[model samples]
Target chain A: MMTALLVMIGLALLLGIVLGYSALKFKVEGDPLVDKIDAILPQTQCGQCGFPGCKPYATAIAHGEADINQCPPGGEPGMRALADLLGVEPKPLNAECGTPKPKSVAVIVENLCIGCTLCIQACPVDAILGAAKQMHTVIASECTGCELCLPPCPVDCISMVPIPEKVDNWKWRYPVIEIKSLAV
Target chain B: MSLFKFHGGVHPPEHKLKSTAAPIRSVTMPLRLVLPLRQHVGNVAKLMVAVGDHVLKGQLLAAPDGMISAAVHAPTSGTIAAIEERLIPHASGLPDLCITLNADGEDRWGDHQPLDYQAQEKSAVLDALRLAGVVGLGGATFPSHVKLRADDAHPVLTLIINGAECEPYITCDDLLMRERALEIVRGIEIMQYLLGAKHAIIGIEDNKPEAAAAMRLACSQNSISITVATVPTLYPGGGAKQLIKVLTGLEVPSGKLPTTIGVQCFNVATAYTVHRFIDHGEPVISRVVTVTGRVAQPGNYEVPLGMEIFDLVQAAGGTADDSNGLVMGGPMMGFNLPSGHVPVVKGTNCIIASAPALFAPQPPAMPCIRCARCAEVCPVNLQPQELYWFARADNFEKARSYDLFDCIECGCCSYVCPSRIPLVQYYRYAKSEILASDKARQAANVARERNELRLARIAREKEERAAKHAERAVGARAEAGGDAKQAAIAAAMARAEAQKAEIVPQNVTDLSPLVATEIKAIDARRGKVDDRD
Candidate 1:
């Protein structure tokens, strides 16, 4: 009986090795689209896309579930870029999440802020750096301008202040190409 | 065609109770008006009248610049207040070249000449239609003359007047057919004459029984050959292709016009506009608009092009409690205005002051499980699942290969997705991106070809010069002072070359990797998550 058990174990090990070798030899190349979508999205942990985060949203889009236009923060250009990647026609950004405005970060008026955590909780990307009792400060560079944090501030202390235009941040809008579209 | 249609259409709840039964109503001339130059599909019309210029109703304000464009005229006697870039009814909220007018209230007409279209030849009718600035009033705003002039190779045999106002909550066209059936018939006759078609067919949806009865009565009275056929009240059964299929019993081949099948289509209103343009010498300046959806009052309104969305809302008795701004056109194809400040355009069909109750605000979109529902509902018979896959993966090549360019972006696939995936948006994005890439590729190709020609030109010129120099041997010694002068010249040329090399080539590094990595990484991760979902 001991010899029989040893033989069974040896056979199982041998089978595993052969299967693993075969799997490694004939692996399918992953979709290159995943990389293209990930590149267009602003890598913020913004849950505004309804996905857990930007990365997840990109993945969902890759899988054919999520549309490229849901990210209001990405605006029309981003939608176009995603559309170009996906080979779909781009529509206007879904107006449900609000119109795409110029990039803005919710600024907390320290004097007016009631030290409430409402704004903190409203932040989809957690770009606001603060505690419950402390006046919140916006991480300007990290904010995606989704405006999620502005509404929940009980005191109305948060306002979407537009990012100051500077040489560093000022990039020309990607030139739009004329597309021949029929009235669909 | 299959029993079920294709992707991206929505069944917005029909709120036709208010205006469906109500007859079409004409309103008093708006005191002020904004007429955009680029109201149609082509180039912006050249401004013919400007600030302080007095003009009567029917006076041309902007003249067509391109062959595929239309001219603009005053809806009422008015003084031009300003001509500048103003917000027009567009989804992107971009400014358009617009002419603002303050009505004089005289509402006087110019020396109008209503013609007898039957007496004239087809070219005469087309010329008259062009001069009057008539276009397809079915919201496409395409030049009517262009459509009327069918290709000789595929001569048009029939005229299809679309009366299928199948969009929920909008009843303007239904109201028009019910109230002004005879005028519509007259319009159909004019379109028939213009195209020299064998017959004309008016397609009214079954839902509008009153409209069908009216059209049939009008057709019988005029002894017109036009047939009023009642089609199913499908949301986009009114769409050009769908209507053509329903009428002709033949599908329009993909990427080709209905004219290819010897059929040409125009909206009922467009026929009327064409009639008025040729017979009565009237330009397309005014048409019917339905003011409804989440408002205090709703009705069919005849409004001029470039009327403000806000004014339309006000005319409908102001907004209800849950007003969420406005969507111009039917809920299915209409777009939410960025601001109510945008004025109406030629394509403005209905203004829906939406609310969460009527037009439910979207919730979080969950991941798709590849159920293929989007592909199933698509009227265009497109495989939306495959599109979504390539699009999400950003594999544009694959998406294009799947005929992503053919997607009409009708918002039907996105509307029907059980997971609430916004499929129309994806198609739009893909289309735009593909266009941009294609343009880039074209420009690059043109540039490369041009550069190659330029280099070859330089080489040819060098060879020709050498041959010419060889023809004159003695002049070579005279042309150059000895070896000392040649050495000096060579040194200067070397220095100039060195300066150009140091300043130019190194500065322009290939950005493919930097960009490919920066954007592709985020996209790949997005793709990866989609795989998991």
Candidate 2:
């Protein structure tokens, strides 16, 4: 009986030592999983998902503190991808954040810009190019059309416009939706 | 040369006799010629002539924007009335940028000079071909120069000329082979030399016996290593990959091109056009197009590019009273033209005047019973039934996994479908949706990248501004001399000391009794354990 007790104690001690060593050997600094989740986000920094930036949202997602469907900008495909990655069921985008809309880019009415720097400070992407007391312009190519700058622009010169489709950008039109025909 | 057969191909009835009996007749130049800038599958040609500019025959209206595109030229001496949007002959019925030329009726020629390819450099010959606006006269209309380009990594072992005009009611290629077989052979020789190919194979459907004989005779006369190969008469046998498979018994791997397998294919009519451009100094201004079905006098005509289909139909002894719709290509692959106002482009091989009697309308669709007829006739050997299901349900991921993009849209599955599922249409829809989604993802990625770059740029700017501010302050102090620097250092040290003095530690005596008792117990337990050790 004494020998059995001793062997149990000895095994427990060995297991504890191994666990301690592994804790030190495989120690990871910071949450690398959060970074991975962040990499998949659109990075608009729009704050529509009730977070300050995409990184915070990614951190929440990694910690299981937030649902993957909260991002409307990412749309259904993005949600599906995230769900696949997380091994969870895909859900519809959370309507509380916003609905997915057609892609657009911010355009500034050049004549209407009042040389205010508030829009520049509000822009998360720094897409606005200007200096103090200078006319601000949105770099259409760089702008994410997040609409964050619109709220801060006192003059309200910024507007979102749909990108025009050209011949090179034209895609095949979907045919008339018809069921299988009986004709041969 | 021995030929091989492909999988699951249907033998469509060849109606070449309907138009092959008549020789290629040249039609008079139309009053107005409308040339769409994007006739070929590449970047649209850059506009060279502005509105209201007088141009001569063969004058360049637009220059090729990139290597994959072909130049656009004036079919005849004309004045540029407008460089505006016009209806292009596509299934979408969308308007594209076009150059409207009002013909001057002079029938004049420009200063075009032919090059003796044997004496000239290969690159120079390719450049001449590019300038001549030569493209594949086949339905694909890919620029000829791009195909003839040599690749050292994948050397061309054989060049196959596609004479298999397998689509029903399309006899342009057959008639061209019969009339201009010698010129076509000359073009093939030039291409073979350019590509440095060891052998050239001319693949013709067995249905066109006279055209095949003419090509064989022409090839023998040339004394080149060219073979007039007879392939089985099957729909889509003229597809580049399909013809390559038949001629060389090789399968072009999915997502790869025939060039990767040391083979290149071109239409026989394209070869004839190349000969005309290189030997005669003529541009691709006209092509033989078969106008049959529901017309009073159906025949092949050498119609100039940009002529309206309405005029072409009229030239074919006018459409019959029963003619209701017009199809720009063959009945199987062609789409109904929105109207007759659309102009003929380089890819317009045949214009079938479709009617309810001639081309009967399909009955109501029935649900798929999984009969597998579509799969049996699929030339690419895809599971058309499964693809149809996935495409209908918008399950693009599954469709993509099944290699949906590899579908050539030859309409073979649709033609053979027992349920009349319009399988190709669904596939096209799925393809477009997938493409659109991919584009969206790309746009999103680009936005994210730009945003990240912007963030980095902003951070750098902030750091630089802080550094500049510090540097400016230091420079100002230095300019004030040594006394000022010493005084500033003393002030900074005093402020640091004052800030440090503001922070004080809380006294241990202020702790609550409960916390103090817990700390004492913890300390006593630790002391007892230390003593035991």
Candidate 3:
């Protein structure tokens, strides 16, 4: 009985070592999904989707905890691309999170003057650069259009004007209905 | 094998008892009614009567243009106040054409007849459905007439009646089954005959035992071979695929339908409407709706089509202070209405007025940790995380490879996501975006085709003019016919001018063929595409 027990113990240890070695040998390598998801993101560096940046959001999408609809900047197209990537059926944008509004940036009224720096602090992407108690102006370039600056403006001067459809901003509209063959 | 439990189905507290306990009641129609033009799926009905023209209830207000379309009927006898654009019952608060009527207060019916629906030919029954403008009221809003008219070879063996009111806070179907089970059964028989199905199975969720019992009893005396089977309580059991699966243990193959598996599915209300449509020749103008949630007397009410939702809200003891989000249909798959002012269309199932307390605020989305919960809950086995990652990367080419279209947008993924990610919303956005891009491509293609045709026409005209000039020159060469040739040349010039004038309007009409011909041409084009190897 002692000999049999000893043999069994030895076999178990050997199997464990083999399994450990095999696991080390056969690592599945890096994931391609995270890289793909990260690529689709606008790279605004805004944490509007609750992820710290685009990379974290992409990772969450790969892991399945987050939905592709969380990012407002990506809009409908981004959501659809993510849905397609995730192999899920696409649905309408959840109005609760918000609708797909045109890309807009906050324009602070230069004359509203009392720059308490509240708008700067509220800016998710650090789009606005202003000092405390100084006459502040909006640096339109970095504005992610999350409207975070609008709420903090006690004077209600910051407004989101739509970005014009320029050649650079223009995207082709996708097809609405799938063309099916006519069967008589 | 944990009973195929899917990810992302929310366990919303059933507030069904508010109206479930009460019987179905007929609501009072106000002094006015407004019927929308594009209520059902397919092309909007063409208005038959002009403004100020009087119409009776159940009267054909609009006529169908084609086989795929449905006719619109007047809900009540009234003077046409206006045929104008109004906010349509849609998730995206958009406006659509509507027929406004100042009710003369006389709810009158037009000419109609009853028939042994089985004796009537399938074509005639389909005509009845089309004439009545019958559409699936179970959120799909598909033309009922079109659904029954499947291809010659695709034989329907079983008619599956969907009674799975699995969505929380919606008991309209339940109340309908309990109150008018006989009518529904009769409608089911009509559907069975319409589709030439051998047997009929009514699949009701186990939650509505009372409804199931009532349906069973109603079909007891009927000659139709109707069987009522109780399905396990699941959120989307009401979906066409899920209901058919539960009833027959059959899987509708990917990219196929229940009809392909010899099964035809219809909502319970649609079945009831079918009976009225076939038997009495009454067009579907209105439907029974459940007005409940955050209001005082919440229950099922028979409301007219295009009736203002605010009217019902008022009749149901008005909206309470807590009614923040007013959603149309059930909690899970329903759409949020911009305001309650939007008129009810054929697809409007239920109007819910719930506060944030009921539907809690969403927290920030956290990173996914490679959990396979989404895969486990997916009714269709799909790698959701992988797809999500690809979609986020804007790699649609790779996403298509994953079969994105097969995702049903059932909200199962969104419901179960611990990170509170609106997964379904993302999918919708992606689909719309893809669709929009595809549309742009198609429009471009169409423009290119039109340009090519215009160029060809110009070349042909140029050739014809040159030929006419050559003919005139030849005639002038024949001796003293120079004067006649000159006259002929002048006439030819005049004729050419006339042809040029004709090309503008005549060819413009020729550009877009008659609506029917255009539909036919579109179908023909589709056939060519399908015939492609």
Candidate 4:
């Protein structure tokens, strides 16, 4: 009986040492929880979530200091995705932040553009191309439709326009009806 | 040879006799032709002719833009009227870039030479096919040259010719086979030579006994060891995968091509086109389109590409008074066209003029009774009801997990659904949504990468500026005096700190005042705790 008890204690001690060694051997460098939360948040960097960027908001959420519903640009779907990842109940998007809107990309009216660089600086994706005192244009394909550049245009030349659907971009519309020949 | 059978399929009514009963006739040339740049899938062909330029018949109008695109040729000698947005054949009824040409009626030919495939290198033959605007004529309109190109990994074994023509009211292939069997056999020989395939099989439906007999006779006359295997007549048995399954007993895995399994499939009409282009010095400027349903004279016509469907329908004795709608393909798989004015594209196989009595109006869709009849007829063996539920709810992830993309949009599920639910439409909606979202996600990733690079560039620029300032200050301090070295260092350190404070990335927004205050408070509380410890 004494020998069996001693063997059990010895096995427990060895397992504990191995577990401690493994903990140090393969340690992850950064906070993976923050990374996962950041992945769930839309990287709009619009500051509509009251944080500096998506990363900061994600970090705040990881630290238990921020609610998961603070993101407005992410909308309810984004909130639910985050809630699923964080194992929490999804809450309604915080009204203190901006309301969700349809995606719109910034379009600069070249004739009205005052050649100011403020809008260019405000763009998070660096999608605007122009020099000072020259006409600026937004690369539509690259623009995230974030609407962040609108506030920085001193001349109000920048406008958020909904992306137009082309023939190729169109999805099949529903409720197809079948018509047969009556005179046959 | 024995034939293999596929899992699930439906046998739709074959009304092919309405058109195939007569011989194929050439349509009268329309006044103008409107050719869309994006006729054969892939990227839109780049325009090679400008407005007002006169082009001859078979003149290259648009060059292939990329590897997967097909070239566009003028259907007849004409003056380029306009290169503007015009309505083309599509489900959406939207306008896109098209070339409008007014035919001069002379039918003048362009400078061209027929290629001797046997004498030329394999690569040369493939290149000629690409230059001649050859593509699969089996509705998908994929570039044919890409399929014929030899792959080192999957050595070709069997080449399957799709003569099944399973869709009801579509008999263009059947007529082409009965008329041009020898030409198709020659094309098959050329494909076999190009692919180095050991065997070739022509798969036709049992309903087309004449076509099968003619093809078999042609195969024997040419001494080409091609087998004409007749598959069971079923809706979508004509599909590349289903035909492959039926002929070779091979199930092309989901998300893979037949070429990956040592096989390649092509439409018999595509084979005929290739033969014409290679042997007769012609480009694909026209194809045989079946015009039936509600017309006085329903028959197959060799219609020129870019001929408006209205002209084709009018050539078929025009639509009857009872006709209310037009469908571009067969009754089962076709979409309703908004107008007959849309130009005939490379993929226009059949046009059906619909009337209230011919295609009886469906009752309002009743709720699915969980009867699972749709699942029974799905050619891809997908749970159509489950897919319908997920698609209607906009839960695309679940739909994707259920293999939504595997659906070939054959309309078998929709055709068999007792509730009259448009199951294929829902699946199409889901598939398109998934594709669009995938594209959006790709764009987002690109933007993210660009944003990261911008931040890195800003940091680097700030560092360079700080280094330049420090260098100038050091030079100034050294030139001033050795005794003022410590003061100079202190001044430089303060300036560097200030520069660091000012050099913030533009993409990162400033924190809100409330959050900033809260963060500061937390930091202070942590400091106090550390002190107490």
Candidate 5:
């Protein structure tokens, strides 16, 4: 009986040492769940999710402080991806934030801009190019259609222009599969 | 010779005799030629000519933009009318940048000279071919120089010439082999010399006996020994991978090139152009196009590049009265031309005037019965039904895992599908959707990285500003020489005294008499309240 007890204690000690070493050696640096949630976000930096940007929203989601469906730019598909990652049921997008729309880019009317530099300060991606008292222009490729610059423009020169589908960016649509009844 | 068979293939009715009835003829140049910059399978060629520039026949109108791209040349002497977006001969039916050339009718050749390939370095020969704008004339217009490049690391062992011409209603390569076998054989010798290949084999479908016989005779006459093997006539047998399997008994690993196995395949017409560029000093100015199905004259014509299909139909004695529309390739794989005005590109081997009688519209697709007929006929040995299910459900990951990209879209599955489902269309949709989503994911990753970098930069700037302010404060304290607090108090007191001196009651002097009386009464009441407090 004593030998058996000693064997059990010895085994427990060895396993405990191994487990302790592994915990120390393989310790993660940061919250990996936050990084994963960030990856699923569209990174529009639009702040429709009641956070400053996509990363902060991702952090909130990771911490259970925010819902997965708060991002309008990400839309339903992104919500579903996040739900899949977090092993939760997907819910409908929160309509209070905004409705999903086609991707667009900000176009600054150079004549009406007035060189106020308000839109430049509002753009989170730094896609707008100008200095104070200078004509500003938005780099269409880099503009995430965040629409943050819209409210700050005193002259209302910034407009959201939907990107047109051309041969280069055109995508193939889903195939139409008819569900015929077998009774026929 | 012992030939190996691939996993799955179908035998479609051979409709080639209709076009092979007559020898290849040259068509008259159209009034205007619309040449798209993206005829090959790579980056669009860089335009070299401006509007109103006069170009001679075979003059370089656009140069290859990068590796794996082909140069574009003038088919006939012409003046550039416009460089604008025009409808191109593509399944997408989208308009892209095209150079509209108004034919000058001079057909003058530019200054050119044939390359003495034997005397020059192999790289020089390949470079000359690239400048000459030679490409595979078989449906896929991949640049020929890119394929001919053989390095010591992957030395080409065997060269396979594709004379299979297996697609129904297309016989451009068949006629080329029958007539210009000598030139093609000579071109094969040049490719062999460049690749340093041990031997070359020309695989022609047994259906075209005359083409096979001519190739055999030409091979005998040539100094280099080239074997002429007759592969079984099958739909999509001319596909590079399929033909390689028949001739070499080797399967190109999925997602890998045939060059990985030391084998390279070139279309027969590509060889003819290589011969013309190396010997006769000619670029790819024209290609043999088969105009068949519902036409008065169904024959192969050596049509100049950029000639509109509408004009080519006229050259072929016009279309039949019952002709419904024009298809740019074989009925199995071709798509209907958006309009007859689409021009002939380097890949335009045939133009079939499809009619209700020729190609009946498919009946509405029925639900799959799980029959394996599609699996039996798939040339790439893929499960079409499963891919169809996954695609219909928008499960692109599942479709990708099922090897959806391995499908060649030969239409054999759709041809044999009992339910009349457009299986190939589903595969095409799934493949394109996967590619688009992959692209979107990459873009999102890039945006995330850029956003992180910008945030880092902003934080760094803020820290630097804080550091600078701290440094200035430290410097000010050092200048005060151990009396910094006292100096700050003195400076604050002096600022207060300056504020006292600057203060003045300007409104008190400017008030009207009645307003001044009311102000004085209010001030007397306030003084009484203050005295009470």
Candidate 6:
């Protein structure tokens, strides 16, 4: 009985040491769950989620501080995707956050722009290009359709223009299938 | 030659005899032509002519924008009316940039010389072909020069000319082979030389015996041996990969190009255009289009590039009274044109005036019985039922895992579905969704990178500004040599004094007499307020 107890104790100690070594060797640098959640987010950098940016919101969600359905720019599809990833039930988006709108890019009314650098400072992606007292133009391709630049513009020269559907960006719609109800 | 068969295909009824009854004829040029820049598959051509500019026949109206794009040429001498968005012959029924040309009725030719391909360098010849706007006329409209480009890794061994014309009611390639077989053979020789292939084979469906005979005769006349092998008639047998498989007995790996297998396939009509461009100095200004179904006189006519479909139907003795809609391309893989007013594009091989009698509306889709009928008819050997389920559930990831992109959307599975499900439509939806999501994901990644970089730059700038202020503070402390706070207060006082000294009034001299009187009254009131302070 004494020998069996000693053997069990010895095995436990060895297993503990191995586990400790593995813990040190394969230590992850940051919260990978936060990164995964951030990847699932649309990365619009819009602060409708009551956070500074998408990454901060992702961090809050990872820490259980923010709900998944708070992002309006992500819309219902993104919430569903997050639910699937995080193993949670999807709830309707919070109506107070804002409603989802079509994708748009900020267009600067060049002549009306008072050369204020506020819009450039407000942009998260550095898509707006201008200097002090110079006309600023938005790089349409790079602008993530974030409306952050609009309110900061003193002259209100920045306007969010919805991107138009063209042949290049056109997508095939879902097929229509009619299902007869059996209850009739 | 021993030909290999693909996995699955369906046999649709051939209504080609009605269009093949007569010889290919040229249609009268319409007064107005509307050419869309995005007729081909790749990037739209860059416009070269402005509105109101006169263009001659064969004049380059737009140049190819990229390697895969093809140039657009003026069909006849015309004045450019407008370059604006107009309805195009597409499944989406959307408007794209189109060039409207008003024909001058002169029927004049632009200054163009035949390309001496044999004497000129191969690259030069390919460039000339690209400039001449020669593209595959077998409905894909892929630039022929891009296909003819030689690759060092996979040296082409056999070149296959697709004469299958497998789709029902599309007789453009068939009639071209019958009438211009010699010229097509010459074009094949040019392609063979360009690709440096050892041998060539012409694969025609057994249904077109006359075309095979003509092609065989033309091949016999040539010094270089060109084999004309007639394969069994099957739907979609003319697809580049399918014809390549039949001619060479090799399967192009899924998602890989035929060139990777040392085999290159070109439509027979594409070869005819090459010959015309290199030998006759003629560009792809017109193509033989088969106008059939519910039409009074069904036949193939050489229609100009941008002629309206209504005029072409009129040229074919007009559509029957019962005609309901018009379809571009064959019944198997074609899409219904938005309207009869859409212009003829390079991909417009055949225009079918479809009616309720010719094509009955499909019945409502029913649940799958799991009979596996769709699997039996899929030419690409993909499981259509599984793809349909995933697509219906919006499970694009699952559908992609099932080789959804490999589906050519040939409609063979839809034709064979026992439940009458629109299986191809589901696959198309899934494929497009996958593509759009992929594009979105890429754009998101780019935005994320840009945002991160901007944040880092802002942080760096903030740190630099702080460092510079710290350095100035340290320098001020060193210069003061005693109390830092006292020196800072003295500097602030000096800065305020300088600002007060630099103040100037610019409106005093320019003020009008009435404004000056109002200013004097305001100044007197301000002096009384200052006295109370």
* Best model number under lDDT: 6
Is model 1 an incorrect, acceptable, medium or high docking prediction? incorrect
Could you tell me every candidate's TM-score relative to the true structure? 0.65, 0.85, 0.65, 0.89, 0.90, 0.89
Q: Candidate 5's residue-wise lDDT over B270-377, tens digit each?
A: 999999989988999899999999999999999999999999998999999999999998988888998999899999999999889988878898889999899998
Q: Mind giving the per-residue lDDT tens digits that candidate 4 earns over B452-532?
A: 787888899999999999999999978877757779888999999999899975533588888778877998999999899
Give the runs in model 2 whose Cα sits over 4 Å from its true position.
A1-45, A52-56, A110-143, A152-154, A164-167, A173-184, B473-533
- The per-model lDDT (C-alpha) reads 0.76, 0.87, 0.76, 0.89, 0.91, 0.92
Please provide, for model 4 over A1-184, each residue's C-alpha lDDT reduced to its tens digit, 9 standing for 90 to 100: 9999999999999999999999999999999999888776777777788887778889999999999999887799889989999899989989999799877788898999989888888888889999999999999888877788888888899898987777878877655565666895
- Report the interface RMSD that candidate 3 achieves against the true structure, in angstroms: 16.5
Q: Against the true two-chain complex, what DockQ does each candidate achieve?
A: 0.03, 0.32, 0.02, 0.49, 0.44, 0.65
Name the runs in model 4 displaced over 4 angstroms: A1-5, A174-184, B481-533
Measure candidate 1: CA RMSD. Answer: 22.4
lDDT of each residue in B1-533, candidate 2, tens digit only: 78888878886666657777789998889999999998887878999998889999988889998898999889999899998988889877778999999999997999887778999889989988887788988888889998888989999998999999889999999999999999999999888999999999999999999999999999889978688989989888888888888889999999998889999899998888888888888888888999998888888999989999999999999998898989988877888998999888999999999889877787656799999998898889999999989998889999999999889898888887777777888898899889887866676667666666767888899999999999999999788788878899899999999998998755658899998999889989999998999
Better of 3 and 6 by DockQ: 6
Per-residue lDDT tens digits of candidate 1, residues A1-184?
Answer: 9999999999999999999998999776875677568667654344567876565787799998887788876677779878877889988887765566665666778899777788766655455777878778877645555566776778888887887643222222322334556897
Interface RMSD of each: 17.0, 2.8, 16.5, 2.0, 1.8, 0.9
Better of 4 and 6 by DockQ: 6
- What would the per-residue lDDT of candidate 1 be over residues B84-158, giving only the tens digit for each residue? 878777766667678998988888987778877778777776766766778777778898888887578888898
DockQ of 1: 0.03
| DockQ, prediction 3 | 0.02
User: Which regions of candidate 6 fall more than 4 Å away from where they truly are?
Assistant: A1-18, A177-184, B478-533
Which of the predicted structures, 3 or 4, would earn the higher TM-score when compared with the native?
Answer: 4
